[model samples]
Target: MTPHDNLGYQRLFDDGLSFGVGFPLTNQNDTMPDVDEELRLARHAESVGFDALWARDVPTYWPSFGDAGQTFDVWPWLTQVATVTDELALGTASVVLPLRHPLHVAKAAATVDQLSGGRLVMGIASGDRDPEFPAFGVELSDRGTLFRESVELLRTVWREDYPEVESSWGTLDGEITLVPKPTTETVPLLPTGYARQTLEWIAEHGDGWLFYQLPQSTLESYLADWRDAAGDTPFSMAVQVELADDPGDGPEHIHQGFCAGTEWFRDYFSGLNEMGVDHVLVGLQSDDPEADLSRFADEVISPRS
Candidate 1:
């Protein structure tokens, strides 16, 4: 069977246009989240009908970068999340391919998928953090090449048992097998943000495409290009939103998204679906997590989903 028939794909993309919460679900990220509270929000998101929960993989926090990576590591954190929620897709917003070994990634991913009962979607990327490249001893320039090779290696090891392969990292002499293959035929790999490859290459290889926030007209152009090469493969994008209390508040432009009211968001989602977007990763930027989460579910997600 094809990758789209996988349970995560069916749950996340087939039922209708689905909405998911990008993690650290609280916009009030002033301090590290309490474990209990974070898990509660995760479970809350599931109850409220979020299709998936995405985790970010930031290896070493660069203070100058203004990003601490993530409070917890991607695999263990997702494993914990898998324990708390039943149906939500547990995803890595992306794992940097150039930094880590593919065998390890495959093993960890399969483990999570097995534990999660086959609900995992991986977003793969050629990383962009400058300091990260040197620290990991990876050449920043060859990221695009490494990104392609990594993808090829992952598919081979995951699908072919004891497969003989020679790769940049090392040669697999077809001696040992990687255990706990993904519950699906293979994990769905969505390439995020071009990953230093041509759109044609991404369209040909990726299970789907994961993009970032874009202006409306630009999005239309991008999706048009996607359809030309990728055809019906799914597309997902992330957006930042500051939910205003008023139903008619301004659609004020923000960095990657908008500060808007519920009604405006509802219409915006509709426009997105019409433009061939299969899923949206909502980054809620408001102060009240519980309240905004529920409201978004009731308004934007309910009608479309």
Candidate 2:
């Protein structure tokens, strides 16, 4: 599989319009919940023409964090979710790369891809919460270095037959073959704000960017920087949304332009397209999950996307 084999990033940007949402892994209370229902919800999203679903890693549920993304462990959930669906792309909102050995990450990710028949996209972050870092014996300050090294090792093992990797994290010597060889050329590995790495580093090395919720103006600025740094490579972001029953009701900003109502949601996404946002992984754990999700699909996502 060559670079061309990866259809997810490209398809996302096609027709100049695309929409996808983040899977609500936890419940409204921000605790680990049964994922069976969430898995079905993901399948529902895919059936409704949604392009992708995201899985987030929550090592320790920090209620203070306010939002707890999909509760299941990232890689294991990816593999499990892959079995329940066939067409929709499966991805990680982000995996904390610095917390685990890159070899383990690579192996786990590759296994998911192989089992899923090459439909896995892994989003990696340097990590944010201070608690998670010490838990893994990784210093919070060194996350950037660890992130860069981890990515280098993952790519080397995946793309090269007998790979030799050198980095601050560790090294791989002699001929090594990372199995399952990503049915596609390479699995899409996106970078998050794991560290304060240069935009040039991300543009040149990462397949995409996993960013936080940002307003339209902010997103434009980010896209410009990314384009300058990355040239033609694609980028993605996660957004919070509150769907309303009223289609014409205006939006009310919750965090970063996340709002309710179909009209406002439509306009927001329209702005995203104009801003050159390739994909948006929305978190729909608002006051009303089913209503918001249904309204979004029927009114907003269905019409424009």
Candidate 3:
């Protein structure tokens, strides 16, 4: 089977690679973007040849924690991004599974996946912001249980013949299958942060892994662990990048990304591909968005060295 059919995501897993940019809705500096501006940014990234545009579900803006992700409701933004872009893929950097029911996520994701003509990629996570969980009347401690149940339920609903599911959240009694099953052979589900699963469990179940930033040396070891866990699957991660014009500007470490020059950025990604990372989604607001996108496309993506 092709990578699209078996891996459950569009495009090849190996053979080449995929580069994408995350929407800069918020940052460590506490800068809030205008919604229209964010949309324009996404469009520009697509036009410049980034394969996918990712949005994070930030129900509450936590400036202290850093990064607001793309603005607007996550589901609606997925639909909006899908409508505006003709080729670029649409994705959720992740949706907090514990906050919304599995059924809602299943239906909405499938609808957007179908509507987007297989461009939608779903990233599921246990909730991150500590305070946000209690505010939603969900106990933060139960997120592990909630996440597993939700994942299982979503898969069941998507099956050709929906199977009965029993879980603490609820149960399926009748033949209530999720409609408009994903046009793609299988839906993509990425697990975020470490969650509660072991490496083996993640390897066996997740389509891809979404992890936080790591140092270059440490990143090698971390990805080694993931490759051991992944076997043959794809893995993705988010990086906080600040690409500069001068080739002399070197990398200075940040919380989850690095500040570096364009050449350094290109070299770093080339190394990442050699290390078995199928995709790398860079957050590019700190750089000159237009120039950075153009330079990266021409210097890095086009060559694919």
Candidate 4:
């Protein structure tokens, strides 16, 4: 499948610079979330012209790590969200490839893609959490190799119909098949955070890049390097922001993101657009999530769109 095959991919990159919101939609930064409230805000986001909604994969909560992403299983969470929202694209940002079997990932992803009407853009990664490695019987040293093999296997199974294949994870012959193919020819795979591979390798294999927040100078350099290697493949990043009530508040660093006013956010996203970032996943930090989402729509997303 080509880059434009999946609906989520097309919605994200084909449009110049689009906006999305991360899950939980709260500042508590804990595993527990008000599911009904999140669903309401998700639909609100789409109604206001956001391009996508991103969900993360975290099988276990490691408190020391300081974040439990939306705290729901990625597949079921995405499927449920898909049922509620008609046009909003759903993404995994991302699924840990080395921790799970490739066949499971392939089947789950295909199912979500089909159910969502081809809206799944899979963000895949080689996990970085150390404890998760041993817990899943995956060696830290072999994660890189496992990651590479998993990516290859996912693509192979998606594209071929009951084809013979063999890998470190397992093997498949013509006798067996993985059913319920993606509504599209294939789901778009965006490799997140290098996944223990070289830039060259990532550029060659990934349909897009999903990255974390970077300082302006650093991001410019990184984007330059990516453009040199990957050509027109899309680049995406996540930024944490707490939109202040005052429209003129300047940016102050907050963890991997910023606490700023809507005015500053407009300028910030405009700069990202100029820098060739195709998508930005906004993680809202607020007590009143619905109000924050509305303010973002009126002030940041509306003007930009």
Best by lDDT: 4
Model 1 lDDT per residue over 204-227, tens place: 889999999998999999999999
Worst 10 residues of 2 by lDDT: 25-34
Report, for all candidates in order, the number of backbone clashes.
0, 3, 0, 0
lDDT of 2: 0.74
Candidate 2 lDDT over residue span 1-305, tens digit each: 56436655545645665667776633443766657777777677777677777888777777777756766688888788787887767778688888888888878888888887777777888888787777778888888888888888888887778777778766668656777677766778888752568888888778877788876677788889888888767777777777666777787778654556788888878877777777887777565555556667777777775
The Cα local distance difference test for each model comes to 0.86, 0.74, 0.75, 0.88
lDDT score, candidate 2, position 57: 75
Model 3 worst lDDT window (10 residues): 1-10
Candidate 1 regions with alpha-carbon error over 4 angstroms: 28-31
Clashes of 2: 3
Instruction: State the displacement of the C-alpha of residue 62, model 2, in Å, after optimal TM-score superposition.
Output: 3.0
The full ranking of all candidates by TM-score, starting with the best, is 4, 1, 2, 3
TM-score of each: 0.97, 0.92, 0.90, 0.97
Quote the lDDT for 286 in model 1: 63
lDDT of 4 by residue, 1-305 (tens): 66486888888888788888999876545757888888888898888778899999999989889888899999999999999888768999899999999999999999999899899998999997789999999899998999999988888888888889888997787888778777776788888998999999999989889999999999999999999999999999989989877899999999889999999999999999988999998888888888888899899988987
Query: After aligning candidate 3 to the native by TM-score, how far in Å is the CA of 162 from where it should be?
Result: 4.7
Instruction: Report RMSD for candidate 2.
Output: 2.1
Candidate 2 ranges with C-alpha deviation above 4 Å: 25-29, 287-291
